[model samples]
Target: MIGNKAVYAGWKAAGMPDMLNGDDHFAYIVGYSDKTVHPQNGITRVAVATIFFRLLTDKVRDANSTLTNNYSDISRGIWYDHAVSTLSKMGIVKGDSHGRFGPNAPITCAEAMTLIDRVLNRLPESRDDLLNGMIQWSDNTDTSKWYYLVVQEAANSHYDDIKSDHHEKWTKLRDTRDWTQVEK
Candidate 1:
C-alpha cells in the first residue's frame, strides 16, 4: 500500500488535472476522523473509486454524476455511490459475476491498473509494443493472468500525451469550474 503523500506527488508529477487554486487547498485522500491517514494500510475499493472521481475535471464529474449502475452491494446516496456509478457508466469499472462490487475489499494491483488504463484510454496495439525494454516486472513470465496485458501497458506507456490532451480539453472549463456543485 502506497502512502497518500506518495500518491499526491505522483499525481502532480504525471501532470494530472487538479482542482486546486490559489489559497484554496484540496486533497483527494482525506484522513480519518482521528486525523490519521494510515498511509501504510491498504486502500479499499470505495476509497479508490472516490479518489479517481475526485481527480476528474469538474465538467466531466457533473456530466457523469447522474449515471447509474446495478451493483447490488452499493446503496444509492452513500458516499461512494456517485463515484462508483459514474465510473461504471464510463466503463472504467465492472462488478463480478454475481453483480457484487466489494466496496470494502482492498483494491488489487490488476484492478488498479485496469482502472488507470481505462481512464487514460490506453490500449496497446500489439504485445510487442509493450515489450520494448520498458517493462521490468519480476513475474513477467506469468502471462495467464487476466490483467497481464494491462499491467504491461501501464508500465511501458508514457502519460505525456494524456496529460497534454486533458489540459487542452479542460483548460477553459477549469477557469470557471465550481467544486461546490459536486457532493463530497
Candidate 2:
C-alpha cells in the first residue's frame, strides 16, 4: 500500500503523462493484491516501484538535482508521465529513435549497469574510500569487458574481493544477510 501510494505521489509531484513514451499502460495506484497480475498489455508493479525507490536514493541527491517532470503524454496516468520524464532526464532510460520511451518494456542488465555507473560517479568526495575509485575517473586499461575490468579494479583497490564476479559469488553482493545467524 505504501509503495503504491508512494509511486503515485512521486509521479504527481513531478508532472503527469510524458509523451516521450507511447505506453498508455495501467497504473498500479491501488496497491497490489494477491490476485493482481499483469495482463497482456500491462506494466509490472516491480519496475514502477523500483523507480519510485530510486528517486529517494542517495544517488539522486548526489546528482546535484531533484526529480522533476513535465507531462508529454495525455493518455497515460500522471504516475507514468512523471516517472518516464524523470527517468529519461536522469539518463537512466531513453526514448527510441522516434522519441518515445517504452515505459512498459522490461529494463535490461545493460541499462541497469549504466545507471549504477552514473550513480557511482555522483557520490560525495567524502564517501568511503571503497567507493572513491568510482568517483574519480581512471584511465581505461582493458577495453574488452569493461565491466569485468571495473570489478577487478574494485578488488585491486581493496574495496571488494575478486571472487565476487569470477566466482559468480552473488551472495557477496547482498546488502544484508544473517551470515552470523544462518543455520548451517
Candidate 3:
C-alpha cells in the first residue's frame, strides 16, 4: 500500500478525514464495500466503480439516493447502487456478458489502468502511438498486455523514473539483507 499512503496523507493534509486507516465508511461511501464487507485484501470491481464515480462527483454517497442497476448480481438497495449507477449512466463501466458487475471480484491490472487513465482525464492515444511506446517488461512485452497504452503513458509521465528508483532501492535492500520477503 506504499503507493496509496502518500495519497492518504495528502487527503489528511487537505483537511479530509483520514479514512484510509481502516475506516469502514470510506469503503462504504465509495461503494468499495458494503460497510460490513471489507476490500482490504485487494482492489475489487466494486472499488473501481466507486473510484470512477468519485472522480466524477463530489457527493460520493447519499443514503436517500436510489439507482437501478442492470447487473443481475446487483439488486436494489445494495450499498454500491448509487456509485455503480452513476458509472453506468456515464458509460464509464460495464457489466460482463452475463449481466454481472461482479462487485466482489478482484480487479485486473488492465481494469485498474483503464480506470486510472480515465481519472487522469487521459484520452486514448492512437494505437500507433501505443505501439511506438512499447517497452519490455519482466514477464511480457508491453504491447502484449491490453493495458499497454495506459502503462506507456504512465511511464511517459515519469512513473518510469519512480519505478527505476524503487527497483534500485529494492536491489540495495536485498543485497543488504534488510528485507527478503519482497514479492517480485
| Best by the TM-score measure | 1
lDDT of 1 by residue, 100-137 (tens): 99999988877887777666566544454343445458
Candidate 2, residue 182: Cα displacement in angstroms equals 11
Flag regions of model 1 displaced more than 4 Å: 1-25, 125-144, 157-184
- Kindly give the stretch of ten consecutive residues in candidate 3 with the minimal lDDT sum: 167-176
- Residue-level lDDT tens digits of model 2 in 43-134: 43336534443443344424433344332331344445545555556654455556545555665433444444333331111122133234
**lDDT (0-100) at residue 138 of candidate 1?**
85
How much is the lDDT of residue 45 in candidate 3? 91
In candidate 1, list every pair of residues with a backbone clash: none
lDDT (Cα, 0-100) at 161 in candidate 3 = 17
Model 3: per-residue Cα lDDT over 1-184, one tens digit each: 2443311101123433221222233333433245544535676797768765654433333422348778888777786778787676655567878988889998876566566554443434444433333344554454655666655444332211123222211111111221224322
Quantify all predictions' global Cα lDDT against the true fold. 0.65, 0.38, 0.50
lDDT of predicted model 2 = 0.38
Sort the candidates on TM-score, descending order.
1, 3, 2
Per-prediction TM-score: 0.65, 0.35, 0.52
Candidate 3 Cα misplacement greater than 4 A, ranges: 1-40, 59-66, 131-134, 138-145, 158-184
Among the numbered candidates, top lDDT falls to 1
lDDT (Cα, 0-100) at 134 in candidate 3: 38
Worst 10 residues of 2 by lDDT: 1-10
